[model samples]
Target: MTKLALSDEILMKIDKPARYIGNELNSVVKEKDTVDIRFVMCFPDVYEIGMSHLGIQILYDMLNKREDVWCERVYSPWPDLHAILKEENIPLFSLESQQPVKDADFLGITIQYEMCYTNILQILDLSQIPIEAADRTENDPILIGGGPCTYNPEPIAEFFDLFYMGEGEISYDALLDLYKKMKQEGASRKDFLHEAAKIPGIYVPSLYEVSYKEDGTIAGFEPVYEDVPRTVTKQIVTDMTQAVYPEKPIVPFIKATQDRVVLEIQRGCIRGCRFCQAGMVYRPTREKDVERLKNLRTRC
Candidate 1:
């Protein structure tokens, strides 16, 4: 029998019970026993907002493409559900498998904005996972933070075991494969994180140490180990044409912020506003080929 953390009574009380239940059209369903790695991609907000983000959808499609991996979706429950879960002592669960996040191999949270910091803590608390990375045991999920906010991840660095510095498409496969091999060898959490830092675009917070100046500014950021790289580089796809894009995005049961197919005509705005963070990080503005766009438009 399948186990669900949210009961019928609780679902009935929530405004949109669809947010908790999985199996909407286009969602990936796989036998949990068959996969070596289970990754839960989380967004620190309500379902509608998280569903609108394109980054999670792309990663979901990319990870599920691997036969050995099953990627699931999770969003911060609404206040009503949150209260009930806390009151009833129910652990927060993934929308797909309805399993607690601690069971997953990795718990990846996308930090798009600073305001979502509190919500991230809420996710950890509600899921029965440690809120701080330092407190986590070997059995705990590897807490990872990614997305635009990763550009300046210092503020919430203590909460995440590691941060993916740039685009997920480039380095996630290598990271996941390394994790599977390491887990097979019965590697300790510390050992796994140390090895993971070797991968480009992956920044292991524990591997480095930070010192502050008297004025409350960052005085020094140094790696604890001599072997670890002093700086992590951002991963980028050289050719957008060759990049894998999500063809079938998961459709939600209730209305989402964006209820239609969204085409990424281009990445990195050409305007290059001096103060724009996205423009700077995703610079050199690349656009999809007209032929490819036309084909995609016709197919959808």
Candidate 2:
């Protein structure tokens, strides 16, 4: 059995203790020593809200499928526990093993909304990681931001080491493979990030230089190194049927905002609505096959 991060006394005091103690149904648990990479997926919100996000579920399921990777999860602690952690000086921990999130190789935060910007900092602070990406050393976890908000990540760009520009299904494997190879080679964090920038859909903020005009509107934006590509393209899965789908998602102990199983039947839209960010960013609509979805439904 995994040990709880919060003490019995602390758990007793908290409103929803189930949120912190995570041995939920279908949640992935693996031997830490066996994996080369320890990736922690975080949603910068309370457990219930974070648990409802389908993107985190998909990535959690997908990453854990790799024998070399042990992917765990963390969410922003509610105000009650948050205060206690601050007072006690306890590091934020992942749900699976109740291990400190800072110990992980990667800390991937899903940035869905502009409202959760401060919450991102909150996650970092609680994890005992440097709030600024530039302050972090090689010992620190590589901070990554993804989701819709990454399309315009300038506001929170300084906080994140890298941003995944599009659908995770497309480029994550390549990035992970590169990390493993680099780790074995005893490469520096900056060196690894330099190489990572070359990968499709990866945007390393530190690698580029952005200059503002006198009016503070626009100016020059280019890579510092000549080797780096001028443009970081957005990745998309050509075939939705071939993409990964979580057959068995984690069932939270407490009631989540989205309690029932969720199956993503389609991605992107054909309407091309000007107001809809999802329609604009997720171009060229793709859908999963009905039979495949039915099979997934049965598994769920």
Candidate 3:
């Protein structure tokens, strides 16, 4: 499969011209031939902060390894970029394919915490996609979320069609494969989600009806559809050393929070702060495989 030649014109149109150019030494690139799924991996935060996330980079690399899958990036618009989007009426797009978020088969978001709530809305608004799962149609990308915030995936449940709890290494493929198959059969978005809810780690808010007691405590969450779990179990990957990354990283011209090239050192911290969801959800913190860093060291 031939690589899509990222044009200079597209980069020029963007506010941070460097973000679009992918020339980093560690970034991953897969052949375009015989691919099955295309994913637009989005972060609700600005490019600067999101670039500091090593998990996103790892997942992006691993997911792109398959010949059938292509994964790119979309981020919340900066204030200036948001203004440009508002004035130009331009939609949110991916850094790799430069395709609008609407066109992607799966729209995956990394939710590290609660602060990105409004930013999620802003991202969808900028992407020109619906904010609520109920509002979107079958044509829209199946909205998915992951990261620490998924443990209490109640408040934002209305927005995301599916939540990928814990690490998404395998679940990502399962979700996309389900979508690719269901889509081939002309299944509606609702039907796909109802079935997708059956997959472990995928919490589809729309399928499970939530009722609260008079006191506002969650009375019970029940699935309208059959086979949906009463409690959606979080996905966990035992190994981290085998993680994948882009062979040529996307080097942003605009300086990010981590000015130097970045990499993930760990997953799921054990701070044990009762207030923190990730602290509890991602139990049993794990460190990166020391051997993997041999490559990361070369780039740093």
Candidate 4:
């Protein structure tokens, strides 16, 4: 049995103790010694809200499919447990192994909305990581931000080590393989980040220098190194039918905001409403095959 980070006493005091426990059905758990990478996926909100997200579920299943990677999950503690952790000096832990998120190799946060911005800092602080990316040491988990908010990540760029632009399914495998190779070679964090910037869709904020005009408008933004690309293109999956989707999503103990199984039928939109950012960012709408979706529905 895995030892939970929180005590029985602490669990009893919290409203939904099951939120912190790790034995949810279909949740992935692997031996620490078996995997080269330990990635913690975070939603930066309460468990109920975080558990409802389809993107996180897909990534969790996708990453765990790799034998070299042991992907776990974490979510922002609710007010009651948040205060308890602060008072007791308990570190924020992942759901699968109930291990400190700080110990993971990567802490990938899904930045779905602007409202959850502050919660990102809370997650870092509770995990015992430096809130500022520059202040962090090599020992700290690599802070990665993804999701829709990353389209305009300038405001929160300083908080994250790197941002994964567009769909994760495209570039994540390459990124993880690079990290694994670099880790085996004993590459420094700085060296790894510099090389990681070269990967398509990866934006390492520290490598670029931004200058402001006298009127506070953007004057210039360019990479410090000549080798780095001037533009980081967004990655997209051309064929959604072959893309990985979670066949068996973990069922939360409590009722989540979206409790039913979710199936992503399509990406982008043909209508292309001007007001909608998703429709604009996710261009050239691609949809899954009807036959595949039917097969997936039966499996679910």
Candidate 5:
């Protein structure tokens, strides 16, 4: 059982209590429900920024809608908070329920961008978990990842068990279902990943061997398993206009980027930049209803 969470007096001394005490009008709570699968929706950055992400909110909302799945958010603690936790010997816990992250069944990290590489290691380390997948034991939660960064997952490839290449709304659903089946069979992490790799839009790096040339360019990468694909395409949600927008975004008591609360005005982009794969792959565009957006602004 968890001890009393950081008390209000302490929260006052620290930053942003709105972020930690989640009475947000739109926040969803399902951890207490009996669910076979638990997902730790992680953002590899400090809490202030991660709590502000619309993508993270969208996916978290979608996943928790499933009766069999419970979703919890995790973000890398700020440097000062990191020092505080280390001194107190406290593991990273979800802001909503104040439970340790290690209790989850699946650790789904969102590699939003490449720059957060070191932060990803920081997150796992803060959670009292191993940074490398190879070192983790069976008791460790399965470390799944995806996001724009997964398009070129090679940079932080060593950490994630599998990368969801495409749009997560569909891809992660398949992954969770597949994992439930594998869990029933009592498959090992290696073998479970072997099968998860077979799913479209899922990239299991362990099944593909990477070799680098002297010049530092990738010399070759060959899939050891016939089921694995050479390149995984990032998934894009086709229709986001009708998507559930979180109006009562979790407001942090402390200041943060867009701390006032904002709505996802749109999704994807129409002007596809050639160099922008997120644009190229995530074709088409969807905009939130203007009336709804105005409502969001009013509420905030």
Candidate 6:
């Protein structure tokens, strides 16, 4: 049997042991040695809240489709479990193998809300990884921030190495391929980031220098390297049918916040609302085809 990061005693004491013990139906597991890249998708909140997110699931499915890659899930442990982990000095681990998140090649944390910023720090601390990007070494997993809050990531910009702006379905494959190539060639972290910045929609915070006026107003953002672009554009999927959809979502042993089959019928609301950012950010609403959606339903 595999040794779990969380002991039996800890599991028994926790409210939901299922949150730590993965192996749910449809959860992909591969031999670590066979995988070229290990990516951990994190939600800086409890498992219930993270599991309910449809965006994470979509990315999870898309990433796992590559034979060379293995994607796992992790979430912020509840306070009761958090205390035990800290007290025992155990590193933060993924649900699938109970392996340390720091060991993964990429630690992608979805930032849905601004409130979870502190929780992101908590995750980094638990993982035994540096909280700030500058403090991290090549041994550390490249910290990536994504989701809605990335529209304006300057507030928590120092913490992350890169931010994936707009929809994830666009640039992840290119990003992962680049990482794999660079890792094989023994490329330095700086070298990788410089190249990664070239990919459309990938924002490498380190490559850009931000300035502020005395009045705390914006001055201008300039690129540190000549090769790096001054502005990073947002990526979006033009056709919904071409995009990959999760056939089966991982089922939790315990009741999740929303433990039901989720179908993303449409993206980018048609209503041009001035107040809401959702309609503005996710523009030119695209939807999945009726027959394709119907076919997807049968697979589940």
Better of 1 and 2 by TM-score: 2
Report lDDT (Cα) of residue 9, candidate 1: 84
What is the per-residue lDDT of model 2 for residues 1-300, given as tens digits with 9 covering 90 to 100? 988888999999989999999999999889999999999999999999999999999999899999999999999999999999999999999999999999999999999888999999999999999999999999999999999999887778899999999989889999999999999999999999999999999999999998878977548779999988889899988999989988889999889998888989888999999999888888889999999999988998
lDDT of 1 at 161: 96
Instruction: Write candidate 3's Cα lDDT for 1-300 as tens digits.
Output: 223333455446667755544444445444434566778888889888888776787777777776678887877766766776677787777766555788777888999878999999898888888888888986788788888888788889888888987778768778778888987898888888888888888888877789999988898889886678888887887776766554455566567787766666776786878887657776778778777877777754
Model 6 lDDT per residue over 106-186, tens place: 999999988999999999999999999999999999999999899888899999999999899989999999999999999
lDDT of 4 by residue, 1-300 (tens): 899889999999999898899788899989999999999999999999999999999999999999999999999998999999999999999999888999999999999999999999999989999999999998999999999999888889999999999899999999999999999999989999999999999999999998888987678889989988889999999999999999999988889998899888999999999999889988989999999999999998
lDDT of each: 0.90, 0.93, 0.76, 0.94, 0.75, 0.91
User: Cα deviation in Å at residue 88, candidate 5?
Assistant: 2.5
Q: Candidate 2: list runs displaced more than 4 Å.
A: none
- lDDT at residue 241 of model 5 (Cα atoms): 59
Residue 270 C-alpha lDDT in model 6:
84
CA deviation > 4 Å runs, candidate 6: none
| Tens-digit lDDT track of model 1 for 36-69 | 9999999999999999999999999999999999
Model 3: ten consecutive residues of lowest lDDT: 1-10
Best by lDDT, which number? 4
Model 1, position 193, has a per-residue lDDT of 94
Encode model 5's per-residue lDDT on 18-120: one tens digit a residue: 5555545566676455788888888888767887777788788778778988887887776767887788888878765677777778888888777888888
Residue 3's lDDT within candidate 5 is: 43
Better of 1 and 6 by lDDT: 6
